[model samples]
Target: MHGTALSGWLLVAVCTATGAYCLLRLRSDCARARSSAGGEAVMGFGMAAMAVPAAFAEPPSWLLAGYAGVFAAAALRAGWLARARENGGGHHLHHVIGSLAMVYMALAMSAPGGHTAHEGHPGAAGGVPLVTGALLVYYVGYVLTTGARLLPAAVTPRGGGTLAWRARPELTLACRLSMGIAMLAMLLAL
Candidate 1:
């Protein structure tokens, strides 16, 4: 419990950095950077929220509700994008899962005592950290696998348009990895 706060703050930093990076990249002339801006921002914000006080304190009710609501909408949007075939199969799928995961974490964190890491903690959500554990495992695997892809020589491309960001596999993947790591930190605190 004592060490958890440090990790929690670290996660907060990670998420804040990611968010700032994504938003800043969006300003670049490269449309490739701008394309994923919205998604990355949302991921950053969600992870930041989940990381803070993940193991101990309850988030404000409005914050919990707002976080869940926004993510729920993102989930729905992901579902729609998937249906409309607007995004890549893997990326869109991640969005769908990530959005749902956010909602789950929000509600789980907002539970009686906001102690989801240890399901047995006071006000535990179902007294089972099954979802949290599953998300943790998923993020770990994703981060490892994605890191492997980064081992190859990579080049940032230039493009201008809404879809340009899709061309920058490195940035997009890095955003995903950072977000996954942030979520992992939060889950660990739970």
Candidate 2:
């Protein structure tokens, strides 16, 4: 496999793992799981479409339009949710930006003329660079900040059954880190 395909497959793997885990976690915590299930599904499906090999090639135009429409709708819904709740925090902002980044990626893949699919082509013109750059910066910062948050020692639990990191969701953090890496890979592929 070439570099592009390899990156795409790796991204798919990350997203698939995230989506599956999110679904499983949903059984345990309905409210928290409800918020992320749709996003995770989109991530998995989008990455899978991107990762499909040439031997079983699907048209880029189709994939691009589908992903663009899905993510655009998702962004709009997220915006309305934010507005209804008197707005939210970085989580809401990240969802909006992430959806936009996917939309940008889809459009970049669907550039007019005879340009080939994948990044590093003339297809990546227009707003692709700016959007991809912003996403890369944001994900990188998130990973770093999250890592920093993990560094400070929490008060040690006294009881034998106590969990020190009760508030932190390790699985979700792992998924976020994987997504961050996937975002970096996608931008680099560009």
Candidate 3:
């Protein structure tokens, strides 16, 4: 990522932790929950790997291509999931967007004159400006909307007894919100 080393490390930590939590959600009794968590875990870990600071170790082009390939497949799977009648599909739609965004970033970074070519150029990152701008807008809106949804849940009391963190809808919302924020940050860096 095009940022201070500390910020890069912070992104890594947040993404890694989020991925771990998603893995825990795999234990959920709900089949849909397990499926969603598995996809989310992939996203979280992928973001963590991509967020590694350029200053520390610039990833090879082949690795970036691998990322693009992985995310492309993920996008396809998410799209299929979104079309399934039994699934709520709304969240899967978001996963589709997120996976495509990851593919975009990976491809952009792997381009010949990508991130490396723009060193020391303020506000000048690799990738098509229009595409990056659109992603930025999408992630920004996603973060805002998700945060709004989480607000009421934060203040409201629930009648049910305690549930596992993995089963708590509010925590899931919060996790999604955090990932949206992280995506926004990453788009900015791009």
- When 1 and 2 are scored with lDDT, the better candidate is 1
Ranking by TM-score: 3, 1, 2
User: Per-residue lDDT of 1-190 in model 1, one digit per residue for the tens?
Assistant: 1136777788778888887777766775654345456667777877776677544665677888798999999877767666644444456567778888888867765666555435455435532467767887888988898777766745544454333443456766676777877666655555
Question: How do the residues 1-190 of candidate 3 rate in per-residue lDDT, one tens digit apiece?
Answer: 6778898899999999988899989999889999899889999999999999989999999999999999999999999999985885988999999999999899877776567555666434558888988989888889999999898875433574678777877877777887888888788777
- In the range 100-172, model 2's lDDT, one tens digit per residue, is 7778767765666323444665443334566667778987897787666545545344564554222236555
State the displacement of the C-alpha of residue 46, model 3, in Å, after optimal TM-score superposition.
0.4
**lDDT of model 2, residue 23:** 62
- RMSD vs true structure, all candidates: 4.6, 4.4, 2.2
Model 3 alpha-carbon drift over 4 Å, by segment: 119-124, 154-159
Ranking of models by lDDT: 3, 1, 2
Clashing pairs in 2: none
Each model's number of backbone clashes?
A: 4, 0, 0
Q: Pick the candidate with the highest TM-score.
A: 3
Model 1 misses residue 26 by how many Å? Answer: 3.4
